[model samples]
Target: MLYLTIDETNTLIREARTDAFHLEVSDDHSAVADETEPMRRVLAGLPPFEAGAYPDSWREWDELVSELTNRGVTMRRVRVVSEPLTDYLRFLHGLTDRNARLGEDIRWLPRHLVDQADYTTDEWWLIDNAEVAFTIFGTDGDFVGAALTEDPTIVDRCVRVRDALWSKATPHAVYSPSGWSG
Candidate 1:
C-alpha cells in the first residue's frame, strides 16, 4: 500500500492534467466554509473529469456548485443523509443555473437513511474510494477533520448509495417543476 501525505497528494493533483477526486465531509471539516477555491485551482490543472461530494451544512452552497460548473467538471451529488427535512436538497436544486445546468452536469440523489444516525452506509463507502483523503485537523486534533480515500470499499459504498437514492429519487427529466411543462 502506498501512502501520500496531504501536501504531497495536493501537489500531485495540482500538477496533473486530469483526474477524479472524491471528497467526503464530516461536521469537523465541514465548517471550513469554502473548500471550492482550492478545488478549483486543483481542478484547473486537470483534464476533463469528475468529482463527487457528500457535503455537510454550508459546504453545499451554490457558490461551490457554480465553481465546479465553471471548472468544466462533472459533479454528482449523492445525499446519504438522515435528516428530518430536505431543505438542503431543495437549496441545491435552486442553486443550479438552467443555462449552466446542461453544461455543468450536476445531479443529486436523495438517499433513504434507514438505520444510520447522522450518516448512511453509502457515506462510508465514499471514504474508501478516495486516492488521498484530506482531513483538516483542529489545533488539538481530537478526531476533528475530513478525508478522502481510494479504498474499493468506500467507492463501492458510494455507488450503492447513489444507486439506491437514484432509484428512489424523482426523475427530474420526467417530473417538471411548477410553471414548467415537461
Candidate 2:
C-alpha cells in the first residue's frame, strides 16, 4: 500500500484513468467540503459546484473528464447511502447532475440494498478492474490521504463489490434522494 500525496494522487488517477476500460468509485460518506478552495466557498454560501465561482478549477476538471471519456474510459460512481437522505446527501445530490453532464455515470443506492459482506464503509476507487485507491478521511470527514494498490485479488474484490452494489443501485437521473419513500 503506497500512501500518496493529493497532487501526486490526482496526477496518478488522471493518467491511469485514461487507459482503463472502466473506472468505478464508491463513496460511502459525504465528501469533504473544505478540501479545495472552490468547495470552501460552497461551504460558505455558494451553491454546490456553482459554475461561475471556480472557473479555472471547474474547467480543468471538466476537461479531464472529457479527455478520459473521449479515450473510451467508462467512469461510474456509486454512492452508498441510507434512504431519507441526510443533509450531506442532499448537498451531494445537487452535484450529481453536473457530474453526469461531465460524462461520468452516477448512481445512488440505499445501504440496505447492498450485501453487507460485499460492501465497504470507506470510500474507494476501482480503476481498470485492476487497481483500488481507498480514500482515507479524518474524524470530521476531512481528507487525509489515499492508499493505492494494484494487487489482482484486491482489485477483484473491489470489482465484485462494485458489481453487486451497482446492480441494485438507481441511476442518477431516476434517483430522488429528496423524495425517497424508504
Candidate 3:
C-alpha cells in the first residue's frame, strides 16, 4: 500500500502501531526543508529555536511519546548518515535528548563506519518489527509518502538489517557530528 499524503501516512502509522515500533532513518536534508515544522511553530506561537532549546515544547511530540511510552510501547531508532552531517542533521542533534528522555533509544552511525551493502540507503520504518514502510522523498527533499508492505520476506529482511545497524550505531547522546571519527 502506498500512502500519497503525510496525513494518510501518519494515520497508517498510528493505526498499525503495536507494542514495539522500530525505525530506521536515513535521509538527506528533509527536515530542514519540511513544511510542517514551520507551520507547527506558527500554530504554537513558538519562537524559532536559536540552537533548538532542548526540552523545548514540541507539544505533539511530547504528548505522543509520553502517551505511547506510558502505555509500555517500545520505540527505538537507528539513523545512518553520511558525514559531515547535513544542516538538518546538525539541527536534529539538539532535539534528540528529548526523545531519549521519552524512552526512545536513538543511535547514529556514520555512513563510513558501516558496510554500505548491508543496509538500505533510504529512510524506512519497521513497525512492530512486522511491517516495512519505505519513505518516498521528492527531489527537493520533501516527503511525498511511502510504500508500505507486510510481505514476510521484506519484514524479515528489515528486522535483520535493523538489528545489524542498531548494534553498531552510536547512541545519539554520545555521537557528535563535529567529532566524527574514521
For candidate 3, lDDT tens digit of each residue in 28-114? 454434434643453354543435543433655566676767777767788887778764565456567868898778898888888
Count clashing pairs, candidate 1: 11
**After superposing candidate 1, which stretches have Cα over 4 Å from the reference?**
1-73, 80-89, 98-102, 106-145, 171-182
Superposed Cα RMSD, model 3: 5.4
Clashing pairs in 2: none
TM-score of each: 0.39, 0.79, 0.75
- RMSD (CA, Å), candidate 1 to true, equals 11.0
Q: Write the per-residue lDDT of candidate 1 for residues 35-117, one digit (tens) a residue.
A: 34433433354311246543443343344445544565444433333233233323333344442353333333333423333
Q: What TM-score does candidate 3 get on C-alpha atoms?
A: 0.75
Report model 2's TM-score to 2 decimal places: 0.79
Local lDDT at 75 for model 2: 71
What lDDT does candidate 1 reach at residue 119?
33
Worst 10 residues of 2 by lDDT: 19-28
Predictions in order: lDDT: 0.38, 0.68, 0.67
Predicted model with the maximum lDDT? 2
Off by over 4 Å in 2: 17-46, 49-51, 55-59, 178-182
